[model samples]
Target: MHPESEDDSLQRHRLHPSSLLFSFLGQAKQFFLPFLLLFFAAGDSWELWFALLIIPVLVFDTYRFLTMRYRFAPAELIVTGGVLTKNERHVPYARIQNIDLKQGPIQRLLEVAEVRIETASGAEPEAIFKVLSLSAVQRMRGRVFAERGEARPEDADEASAGRTEPAPRPELINSLGPKDLILLGLNPGRGMGVVAVLWGLAWQMGLFDGALNFESILKFFTGSEEGSVLGYSALALGFLVSLFLLSITWHFLRLFDYRLELRGDDFLSQGGLFTRHSTTIPRQRIQLISISESPLQRWMQRVSVKVETAGGTGQPAESRHWFAPLIHRHELQGILTTIDPHLQIEQASWQSLAPGYRYRMHKLSVIIALGIAAICQLIFWPWGWLSLIGLLPLFAWATQVESKYIAYARTGYGILFRNGAFWRQMSLTMNEKVQVVSQHQSPFDRGHRMASLRVDTAGAGQSGHKINVPYLPTARADELQADLVAAAGRGEFSW
Candidate 1:
């Protein structure tokens, strides 16, 4: 009921001139090509109609551009559009998960940045913003973060203001030199063999049929039959080798300009060759820390570390969104300790399930393998024995890997679930985030007081990471369930 604060008033409205121009230009660009094609293809009679159509479009765009304005209320940002229908939108700042700035080649030439704000709520324009000057963009970013009650450290502000000289940037943190890049590239996952195989399969399946231009290769490789065959084979080999090299080169390049800087309670990671990307993640948002070791990496005693965060595209393509793709495992413990000293992870104690449970799981794998083998025999009788032989090793491997990697760690704050065969995964989340916990007892498991405990968390996608503790004492599962329910009731994440 009191007067509004100055900060509140300052964020009350935003009028981005560049955004209006961007919107108009984007629409104009889209129509321009079609308009040009139509103008050339159509007769003069149709020209009048085109002109008439263009007039209204131009007028409507101009009117919309002139009227566009955004206002920020205490809880949300409001946008109203349309000279007639009057569409309105309310975007809550608290629900905003990410804010990104994009600039295409044309925008770069114009020296304007487009701001995109994405929210947790399911809404179109989950990201909505306008183009603005780089300086204005920076100011707006500061304001948005400020509204969220997260401001840069006092030292950073003072340094920026020239009240105190900025501290020298640490050479190692800011710049990953050629040697560091080489080391990173030498890591096992940098190899492109798997990618190549996938690409080859896609090609064989005719996925690239539409895009293929056979004439170009034919013109280049045409010669005597034997010579042509040799030349084509050599070319294919070279292409594959180049693809492998390119993957390594790209990995190295991504690390080349890598920079991680601390700004208050958050960390900023910035790096890219062609399209520079910068992400700021608050220390508290991290949900889990995982380390993975490939066959080659395990031999070398090296592994990749990743941190899972809340919300965003949980895809490898958007690796930076949910996880930092490549960090040495040895350094993982140190990083987690630095982020949250309270996090504790001990080696999981092996709790063997009932003998019947293991036997059933093993039988299930054998059954699947046998089914696949029978199908292959019907269709490929000549290669049936080989197919069955190949599947035998796979089934054996699956059983062994599952048995070896199956483990769970109980920490003060959360439970750690670890599992995998070819690729290992570990997840940790606080008790309060747990939405549901259930114990499943198969007929076999019921016979020996053994059951799988599945814990589910919120904000995770449809298939959230569910932990299955193969076998736990019923009392332990009940105790954990009670603790989780209490934490949820208190609306807190407790250790």
Candidate 2:
């Protein structure tokens, strides 16, 4: 009674019953927002239509529940079902890049979680278990890595039978408490939510076309003349207040009671308020680790660390990154020790780019800022001169930012990149994740005998998948590219 003795040698199993709840919710989401709008438009009359839609959603959920089936075959994981079209797939363990666990409000309420198994083929997950218990997820994770030569299958034998023997919760290596969560809520990066709200309002008001007057927005928020400092102060305070309330709600729901653990073979995380969750990630599946902080986080002396997998889509809330999202800066070393002793980023001496690197590094940002200043001057006349004053300092600040934070270093495993001024990021990647390394030279760069290194990896989004290190000596860029290419060849690889 062993798995993989033959190509199709295991029993088909249905997901947890809570999966039906998840499936139904997925269907309801399609029409939920529209229903809400209709409710506002037509009052209680929309309830009947909303209830009518529920019937179809229920039917679809039941149909999916009846058809969906997965099998734990040793060599490959198989998923098959479809009442009509007859869909089926076999994802070999060798191609199974990473497995991620996620939970939404409902799934958390039901005390079950979703498991996403990905292959390097694309951003879409290869196998999805909508709802499974913590014990079941641990068993499945064990089975997956067992096939990958990273764990043992007998550990999941209890899973083959129906039992709830939860795996031992590993000892805490690092964690975030209430105070840290509060600081995370107050972090400046969260202010983007308020900015996005204003931008959306402006777009709706036709401000993108230069139709709306800026003074009117100021008047709407603060009833005072443009010359009054109280008017500007009130407006800024209002936005910050809105940002605080929004961020507090979000961070509390997402990171309340957060904890990180290491169970020898993998790292595990569980957190949330109304909707709790448990996530497991095999150590070898990790492609990169990022340690970062926003201006506010830096000011508060805290950091957020994210773990990226080779198969990630890199979308917020959906990506498998951020296994440990936020913690005090001092605790970073304690957690790094669990992941890998060699990944002590604080100990690594990073080599900064040349002092003149900002000539190229700040080129795009300066262009954008100057363009905004020009538009303000054109539209607002004499008053626009004030904007140029602010823009000038910001433009000058870029060089200082580059001098302080922009740099890269070679590591024993791969390249380490440090970038960003306001939202600082430090990424350490292993050679195995690198797919290609290329050198590029711009006309201006060649004049300075400089070039940039572009690294392509599986763990990247369309934009960030290609890592760029700008303003390096041409000889150094060429030499580093050759060395990286050679190292990539020597390292283990998989699709």
Indicate which candidate wins on TM-score. 2
Task: Supply the TM-score for candidate 1.
Answer: 0.71
lDDT of 2 by residue, 1-495 (tens): 445323233677678877776777777787788877877887877365755867866886688778888887767778898766888989887777666667777666676888887776665788787877767676666566655654344544545554443345567866778887788787747347668657655654567667656567777777666637877667667766887888878888888888877765567777788766556566776766778788888887778887766664634234445566777788888777677767666757788765577666567667777888777777667676678678877877865685688888887778888787677877777787788788888898888898888787656644322257888988788888988988999977754
The global C-alpha lDDT for each of the candidates, from Candidate 1 onward, is 0.58, 0.71
Instruction: Give the TM-score of each candidate.
Output: 0.71, 0.82
Q: Model 1 over residues 197-307: C-alpha lDDT tens digits?
A: 666656556687789743355446664444466676666686676874676687665554666655544555656554455565555655545566656556655555555
* Model 1 misplaced stretches (Cα beyond 4 Å): 1-16, 28-63, 71-82, 85-93, 105-111, 123-127, 149-258, 288-291, 296-322, 346-361, 371-381, 440-450, 462-480, 490-495
- For model 2, what is the C-alpha lDDT against the true structure? 0.71
Q: Per model, how many backbone clashes are there?
A: 0, 0
Taking all chains together, the TM-score of candidate 2 against the true structure is: 0.82
Question: Relative to the unseen true structure, what is the C-alpha lDDT of residue 233 in candidate 1, on a scale of 0 to 100?
Answer: 69
Q: Model 1 Cα displacement at 190 (Å)?
A: 13
